[model samples]
Target: MAGEITETGELYSPYVGLVYMFNLIVGTGALTMPKAFATAGWLVSLFLLVFLGFMSFVTTTFVVEAMAAANAQLRWKGMESRQEEDDDNSSTASDSDSLLQDNYERAEKRPILSVQRRGSPNLFEITNRVEMGQMASMFFNKVGVNLFYFCIIVYLYGDLAIYAAAVPFSLMQVSCATGNDSCGVEADTKYNDTDLCWGPLRRVDAYRIYLAVFTLLLGPFTFFDVQKTKYLQILTSLMRWIAFAIMIVLALVRIGRGHGEGHPPLASLSGVRNLFGVCVYSFMCQHSLPSLITPVSSKRHLTRLVFLDYVLILAFYGLLSFTAIFSFRGDSLLDMYTLNFASCDIVGVAAVRFFLGLFPVFTISTNFPIIAVTLRNNWKTLFHREGGTYPWVVDRVVFPTITLLPPVLVAFCTHDLESLVGITGAYAGTGIQYVIPAFLVYHCRKDSQLAFGPGAVNKHRSPFHHTFWVGFVLLWAFSCFFFVTANIVLSETRL
Candidate 1:
């Protein structure tokens, strides 16, 4: 009880919020997004960026609001806990009364930041009072939030493995790009290339094992105390942005020069393309919109914070997509420039191709944990419980590990990137990123209140803000589901 977080849902420090958002968006997409430009074309890809950006904002806002609800509930529970402590002989009645009086006086006397407590329960009761039945509604809310997180975890692990499989296949091709006669050139018509090379470290079946490891590591990463995990978050984020730039360059080089004959991005399968179907849906490592609405968020500062995030997200994504589109050949998508680089530059473009080729590895390394956290917090808020608290280790490690296992196993078993991407994108990506959020948001908005919060330097609150959030989530879900599913069906006979 001593260490119990009595006042939950407090907005974490701004640094954490900013980092978290950045982290989420900048992952595997860095490598794969360029390929999207190739398929959709620059114009379509830009539109995709805009559409995804807007939906992602809305979904992020909804998440923020939901977090606020949970945090507020955490605070309320804390108040109740104190009441119980007082009743259980925390001190003599006289002492308690005196302390109460002193607290009242001190609260009034504290600095300007300490405002008068004026908010009501702010929770939806099945029927306003009895307090206990509210538990059910609370449970539903938390479950919804945590459920979202769980899906994300599932999606990321499977996604990461699928992407990772592409890496080795790309490495194999470096030899011929430099005009080395030693590099056996495979016949394009035959769909056979002798110049391609796999990573030196891999076994014929290494993909399976790698996928398992990448997928399962979410536990060690996420459960290790997020409070102190800032460093790893930063490192990953840097990698993400750098990768983004590299992707753009790759796309530009291929798309710009009129290669008399177009080269197909070696990764032509639909499954692999899903990595760029929509936004990264990452847990940004830093003043993200989600943090703005958490119960702990300073009400005075909420509006400005949310809008700032919206702008930052828009700018980052829009720019990245634009550059990526310019980097590829028009006719060929996925890895259109697959044969453009020689083996000598294998360290350069080849490394880029490998990672870009392997989207899931980057995703599983990060996104799974973020989504799980989303679920846990939402669960607590909905249930309004300190009891049966969500276990961090389960989602962070066990669940994520389990989710990634199949991809890794498949990679090793088949060494086939095409199959894994198709299955995961059709099933997991479709449901998690697109369908579910959209559905949940629609339901929430049907009978709700609130509007989007204000811009920064202009802090203000809106009534029925929750309603707006529901709408936002729905947008993201639908986008993800439709785009991913369509592509999967196109690429695979199985899906």
Candidate 2:
């Protein structure tokens, strides 16, 4: 009964949806969005901001529906079990656990002592009639699953490189809340040109490493009980609302002082790119996809959801931009804007500021699982061939190492934070999000022209249609090439 709810929307709370969006767009790009505001200016910026929201909505919805459908069919076993899995889908015991935590914990500890073979259990075999599993078999299926698997990894990298950039970016905003002298901006200018210079970041610099380490620590410690953090969902909705309010109040305040204030014009394009990425991330059908694929995702819901989600994303972004623009007085950097940067003691809005400050810890907590897996698995897959049937031998010993790697690497090899982070946008950032999905969508879609799979373009289309797909393929290929080259150049220059 509980498991069913887990798969079903009944157990799927709105806050989980909010986390998806926050995780999707909240990272490093929040800082860079100012650059977009600067490049496009306020007016053009609005349209660009919205355009990203729109496209992401459409693409994400499609990806979610399609990929999830595939996951459902593939995750489980035979046709009979697949059908049973769907029926039990919403009824899965874990689904019930969400409503009652104590019972769930009690259940988890129950011994699997069912004469459980001491040897490696066949992952392929199903003990029950209704079991549907990750159950990877064929090479292509494994590869396909791994492809979507990339999303979780890149998601964190973006947060670390993109969102983490905001710590420094928010400094400038902090300076405004207080004075430059008190904020220590002028003095820090002689020290580090990182996000601290953006506002009141100097105050936190001495403890930034400690803060970063603390955040890193928080992610894994809570791993065994992530759902316990579900209470945070309520807070997420509140912050988003606060952010919305801040955007409005601040935009109105800065109406005349604008013109070309916060994020400029071309920056909007990148804003669009990140939005597109978020939509992809949010619309990702992976978590929910494996359960109900075809019927549950009716075309109507898809259309409405896409439209609504994008509008909200843009609305939220526009607000953030407005608040940051006037607050910084036009000197804002792309990777340095935190909502709390200018906020220390505004009694009325102090809560918003506090959460803004807490945002990094949240991101690190959410992202570390994916990073640990990426670091550990990639380590084993690439370097360590020795494997135990037990996943823990690999997962436990090396997961902590992966968590600690980022700080250690950054500490050892110092580089410009903004430029260094922006550079990641080209490689892991590019391939993990953009290139991989585009390939999956194109390949899986029945008539997609760029499908790397066997039957993409079929006998059905007109010459014009054929030309359109061919052109589309070229466009993606072009983008991929550019992204790869950009990374190479950026990495080389930094080295």
Candidate 3:
């Protein structure tokens, strides 16, 4: 908790918190989902999506409970520290009464309406933001904490790689013409990197040029702090909603006209690996739960709010993917689904095509710097020592360079957004979403029971509070890693 920045702004109602959670979970992942759905087949995708969403919700509750436990621990320690100070000072009776009144007033400010009588269950309320990293430090051993940082670092790298590739890929699709006559590329024509963009420029060459421009433009912010402005968030969210609405509407209209070209198989194991990864990524809000959940003015029905949000997200995903798979042939689907509409033959409107293509460019460019700075800070934290300072060059230059270089190099190697996303979601996302939550809840519960009496109850405990659920989550995580690794091996062998 010491290293993390807690949310200090005004708290909102739970409904507003619900909307924030929804916005957080449904970003880049949703755009790539339609292709995964088509590849894995509609029926399988639907079932898997529903099941994974449920699993994610269960883990989210686990995280919320851990937060409450963390807050309780901090509160209990503060009280103990005050009591120790009072004892050392040998305070008079009046002073003791005054201190007691002060503590009660502070407790009253929180949801708990009672005084902190030593071992009281009511004193443990989630009135503060305890981030996942802080929780890891509290509960995990030294090695476990290091592993947590490593997993997060890997996930952020994958995130940067995706953002790096997406902007230029979108730009290439929008600017390139098949024959240099200003006619847009056809939807069905399979263009490889070797295909001409301009007369002498290959599509890959054009993408690299844009990649360099993108890096030069946005990469410098890694060295400086870049926070998302309130207006920037509003603008990006507005564009996101408009673009998604357009795509869904267009797909429905196309399908209604009986021009639907997708006839997906009932099931396909070959696509299961990526679909698993994609669903995990899509349902991911566990890592940032503290930031999103702590600002809720009331959390009495927090679990129900989370369930409702998941239901809506699942419905939205179904609508988007089903409509998309039906609107376009499976073979013609693009890795970035928006580019599928950038083709003039599919969209028929130049402005709409360009807007759809440029949407990620606008949103991701804003996000890349924030994420890079965060990764750099995390690097700083990992190597940080007590009562010591980093040198200017290492603190300012070294960490940022290491953070930016790997992802850019990955982008330079290949613009395979699907593979990058799949690997990221499957491995690092698994650790963050599933394994970490399970262990956090497990250890936090034990710590809570020990700190408070055995009879103390955590009001925010998950519905799946039994130890069975925690074991089940860990088992599931291991199985997922195994399955994904095997699939990757088989695919490579065939290749």
lDDT of each: 0.44, 0.42, 0.87
- Candidate 1 residue runs with Cα over 4 Å from true position: 1-16, 87-153, 163-229, 246-318, 330-404, 413-495
The better candidate by lDDT, 1 or 3, is 3
State candidate 1's TM-score: 0.57
Expressed as tens digits, the lDDT of each residue in 164-264 for candidate 3 is 99999888888885345355666666888998888899999999999999999999999999898879988888889999999999899889989788888
Two-way lDDT contest, 1 vs 2, winner: 1
Task: Please tell me which predicted candidate would have the highest TM-score against the true structure.
Answer: 3
**241: Cα error in model 2, Å:** 3.1
Query: What C-alpha lDDT does candidate 1 achieve relative to the native structure?
Result: 0.44
Residue pairs with colliding backbones in model 3 are none
Model 2 earns a TM-score of 0.59
Residue 211 deviation, candidate 3, in Å? 0.9
Model 2's alpha-carbon lDDT is: 0.42
- Over 1-495, each residue of candidate 2 has an lDDT whose tens digit, in order, gives 212322334333333444454444544455446544543456656664565445444344434433432332333335547656655654575565563674566459756652232111132121121211131122126566565445444544444443333443343234333454343222112234343432454534533544355446554542332342445645654554565466456455555555323433334433333333332333233233322322231222343443555566666677766555544444433334444233332223555554554454454444444544444453344333355453674456555556445643553244244444444543454444344434444443442212222322222112223334434544653675575466556756978
Candidate structures ordered by lDDT, highest first: 3, 1, 2
Give per-candidate clash totals: 69, 46, 0
What stretches of model 3 exceed 4 Å from their correct place?
1-7, 91-121, 178-181
Model 3: how far residue 89 lies from native, Å: 2.6
Candidate 1 residues 45-162, lDDT tens each?
Answer: 5555566555555544443344333334455566668867765553455586776886687569766531123133343211111121132234346566556555554655565454
